[model samples]
Target: MSKEMLNALDALEAEKGVSKEIVIEALEAALVSAYKRHYGQAQNVEVEFNQKKGDIHVYSVKEVTEEVMDSQLEVSLKDALLLNPAYEIGDKIRFEVTPKDFGRIAAQTAKQVILQRVREAERNIIYNEFSQYEKDIMQGIVERQDSRYIYVNLGKIEAVLSKQDQMPNEFYQPHDRIKVYVSRVENTSKGPQVFVSRSHPDLLRRLFEQEVPEVYDGTVEIVSIAREAGDRSKVAVRSNDPNVDPVGTCVGPKGSRVQAIVNELKGENMDIVEWDEDPAIFIANSLNPAEAVDVIFDLDNPKACTVVVPDYQLSLAIGKRGQNARLAAKLTGFKIDIKSETDMEEFYAKLEEGAYIDAADEVETLDEAVSESDLTADEYENVAIEAAEDEATAAEEVAEANEATADQTEE
Candidate 1:
């Protein structure tokens, strides 16, 4: 049994990568409990194992004292001196108490400990391996599905695809292979849990990296992505090289690269646009298939803007149910209020009308004040001149503001 136990330890270390010393230490502790339980001995005892011989020993430990208060825990100095002359007061001594049937208990304890260690070692290995893949992409096979999650086999372990992470338009079947983004990895009491996603915006970015050589090699950088999974997605890319066009590189020759990604996503539409440093230009580019006539920013809020498109392209810029405008806002990190050219014209017209009404009211108020004051002719004339000057200044300011708006729109 001793030789067999040593061989088992060697096999465990070689096969499972579990340290033999760790198993031996655990086995020794378990044997101590087994000794006390089986023999009904409540004495202070310890267990030791011989690494070379694979022999297990149990010993009763006692404190050497002048007067032994508890026989189970202490030994008298006179009795200890008989066994060993060097025994002194306050010293600890061990007496071998190996039982006749201890080998059987030790064998059982060793088996249980080895099995537990093997399981623990396997869990650690798996956790360490999968933790590195967090926030990355991997191809997995669909094994099965339930109401809550879809199980995907990723080489050694199974990953979970939750309901929210699954694409609505795609139906997963058993044994179907798919690419997934590793959103999170957690080490639980049971084992390692990997949460994967098909709808994450980063998944689109990774797909671009895989399909576009310029993106992978860092010549073209993906600025941002806005995706409505299973429907449509927009990607903004910028190029470091002056000669390379970021948009054309991502689109590929004859749109083959983007088409491959779209097919992989189950007919999801992709709009790849060039990223510009200017927020206005980038926002304009983000609204593809619909050209922006002007981008007017909100002075009070830097992240808010109004994108004015052609009157005919209002529906296209807003998309079906405002999806296009919503995605452009997300990609540009701006709060977008899309307007048509006609809308802007109507807005300006209302402003001018309001100003004119205010001027007329001021004139009426001046006339009322003059009639009530009974001022001399010269004083009244001076008051009239001041009012005219104020009106002229207000009109000039309004015109200048209008001119600035037009100049910005043209640029």
Candidate 2:
């Protein structure tokens, strides 16, 4: 070690944040190993570094014993007393055994140790920097692409955009900048590994936070999101302040807020629906472009429901290949079975006619039961008329409630 090496340590502490004490400790250990390897000594040795003087020293240690069995590791009391009068059997002594030409070896060893520590320190700094960004979003430039991953440069570190995380509608090229969601950050043996995604549902959520002040400041709260990357997504939002309309706030003036997000996602469709406390109303809202006539819950399964829509809007409510219903189910955390108005009517008719059986009863349809009973044609006609009247009245009440809900939403 020299004065120049001490200056380098100060520079490393200031610039790279590596502690001088840590480097000195590592250097001492490396010097001890070097001395034993080069000098071929079997004696116990210790290495120490003088921080002020920047000097390295190697010493041979031996335990004082009554009788010295090994000349290399033990010093007899007679020999120990010659050096120190208070020497005891268990006392130990050190002799300066630093080789004259050891400075050259020390310099080489110090260089290797400092370089290794610097690399490790840099990795720690990068890992700490990126760990804060986990589950957040960041902008990065595309660096390169291989068969498995697309490397994105996120300032201090290169993040990996895997095949599954990449949006199907987007293409990556060198120098192209894109916003990505930080799905995970890992400290691996090689370095810090940052995993980002373009297709994550939260990516949409974060974009809203960035673009919409109401969403970021907690005025409009996004309750749930269901996304099919590169195609369409549904977001359920609610308002903390009664005056704030969650959907309109998220949509911004003239759809500017959501339109910006759509552009970022490469023209992906967005359906922002108002979140309601009532599961029936929420499920109906989740159907978006399609109007749900009525929502019927399953008595046996609390998490399941059937949504009835007008026969003309059945395809729209179900979306193309059931995408709308699927996303709605995901958003509301329910199993949604969509049925047309006619289908629901037929279902009700079957129920009234005893076509559907209870768990404790034998399965029998209307015709089967009627053949076994002494029911006249006029009695059957009366039953049919009563069922029709009941169905009509129930339908009217549901329609009135739905209309009131729609009027309130519009206001």
Candidate 3:
């Protein structure tokens, strides 16, 4: 390697984060192999890389041993002293064995080694760089696409956007810039693989965080998010500060803050609702625009609830195909069974009177009826015997009454 090559290394180090020291070490190793290959011998070898002069030197090493059993690998002290008086028995000596055409060989080796080193360094750098961005948001340009994946150019690296993670109705085109959620980063044999997503629920959360300062700073907290991708999404937010309106803060003046995010998501509908500590109220809030008349929890199963709305809101509460109710269920972590005023009138009337009747009670009554029915013959015989005994007692009483009447007439 020459000074020009060393300058390139320095520039590579600065630009690609590839350490010059690592490159130099790899170059030295490559040259060591080159020296042994050209020599066709296994003599102990050493390579020193001079950083200042940008020079590499190879040496054949021999130990100054008392007995020289292997002359190629060791030297006697008397022979070592002939070359240098300070030579010791255990000291090693170096003889410069650098080939005459070593520079040419090294030049080719350096080219290959530099390319390999830069590739590895770039991979490591990308891995370290993108790993920090996991679960975060990023904006990238759509570079290309295939049936299975779309490649997005993320400045230094291209991230894969799988078809599965894409928005349902969003159409992609070349050079279209879109915001994406960094779903994962992996270190593969080829390099670092970054997978981005447009359908993840966190994508909405991160978009809001980026647009709204209150959410990023913790004044407003995003309680939960449920997204249907390119169609509709619901975000439940709670304000730590009583003065801050979480939903209003996210909506911004004239609906600008949310609209910007909506535009980024290709006009996806967003419902930012205020989160309530009371799940009943929260579930009601989650079904926005369509007023919820009542929300009743299934105490037997805490994760389920039945929501009641006005007759007019039945279709609105359920959306075109239950999209609103589905997103509400996801956002509230409850199984929502939405009913209209006219739909389940009996159910609401029970709630209006402040009472609940278990359907299980009706089942128990039916069981009792089944047990009373189909009686045995022995049971019927016992009933007939009791009736005959009652009739005989009545006959005895009538005979005594007649006797009393006769005695009164004689007197």
Candidate 4:
């Protein structure tokens, strides 16, 4: 042991978080093992470590007895008394048996033990540091990609973005920077494995927090999210402060804030809707880009709703392949059934036109809302068909005007 050894321990403590005291203790134990291996005998041994002098001493313990039966473990009374006059029987004594040539072996053993402990200490530090970040968001650069996974370098570690967690139709290249959600962290024997996801719903929520200060500070709360990664998503937001408009806050000035998030997500369209306690109002708002005339909740089954839109807007409300309606249902936790006001003609002309499968839509005459009994089935059919034609013509004009407005906005 020397000052150089102490200096190295201090460096380990500062740089690797390895305690010098712990390394000293481990080194003391290793010295005892080396003593036993070198001497090739069974004897009780004790190690003394002096921190101030950076010194290690090995001692053999022996019981003081008047007659020594085992010379290796028992000291003769004469010998004990030579060192100490008051030495008595059964008193354990320490004998300095430090090997003269042990310095070289001790130094080698200490180096190996300290290095092993430093690695373990560093691993524990990293595991604890990253565990706090589980389920949080991080920005990382694409390191590489293979058929099975994409490796993203997240500052301290390489995070795994598995194929299943990747966004639909999204591509990545080397050095591309993207934000990811830290979904899981596993402390494996090899190392800490971090799993990240780009398509997680919370990724969108976290992006909202990053871009929208009101959301990050808790003035606006995200109620729900439904996402079709790389295509579209819907978010329901509510304001904690009544004065602040939650939807407007998320959208920002001239849509700059939301557009930034959209660009980050590779142009994934997002719809921000004001959250409402009343299911009727929320369900209506969730159907964005489509005007809802009325939303009626099923009294028996609250998870179901009937939404009515103009005949021409029905296609927009249903979306291509009913994507809009499906995503709205997921966002609001309700199963939605959509109907058009002018679909009564299709219902009456099922033999010729396609059948109107929406059972909730029972269209009535234009004069007044007709009950089931006011007119026979045939009379109701005749009145509904006439009213449907008039509604259809008016809906077409509205649809055309909406298209013109959208085109102008795009320009």
Q: Identify the leading candidate in terms of lDDT.
A: 1
- Give the higher-lDDT candidate: 2 or 4: 2
TM-score of each: 0.97, 0.86, 0.74, 0.74
Residue pairs clashing in model 1 are none
In candidate 4, the residue pairs with backbone N, CA or C atoms under 3 Å apart (3 or more residues apart, or in different chains) clash, namely none
lDDT of 4 by residue, 113-224 (tens): 9978987897788789888989899989999988889999998789999988999878889999989999999989887889999999999999999999999999999999
Worst window of 10 by summed lDDT in candidate 1: 355-364
Higher-ranked by TM-score: 1 or 2: 1
**lDDT by residue for model 2 (43-71), tens:** 99999888888898899999999999998
Clash tally for model 1: 0
TM-score ranking, best first: 1, 2, 3, 4
Q: Compare candidates 2 and 3 on lDDT and give the better one.
A: 2
In terms of lDDT, the poorest run of 10 residues in model 3 is 352-361
> For this target, which candidate reaches the highest TM-score against the unseen true structure?
1
Q: Write the per-residue lDDT of candidate 1 for residues 1-411, one digit (tens) a residue.
A: 487889989999999999999998898888889999999999999999998888888999999999989999999999999999999999999999999888988888888898899999999999899899888899999999999999999999999999999999999999999999999999899988999999999999888889999999999999889999999999999999999999999999999999999999999999988899999999999999899999989999999999998899999999988899999989999999999888898898788777777776777788789878989999998888877877777777778877987787687
Model 3, 268-329: lDDT tens digits are 99999999998888988999989887776778998988887888888999997889999998
Kindly state the number of residue pairs that clash in model 4.
Answer: 0
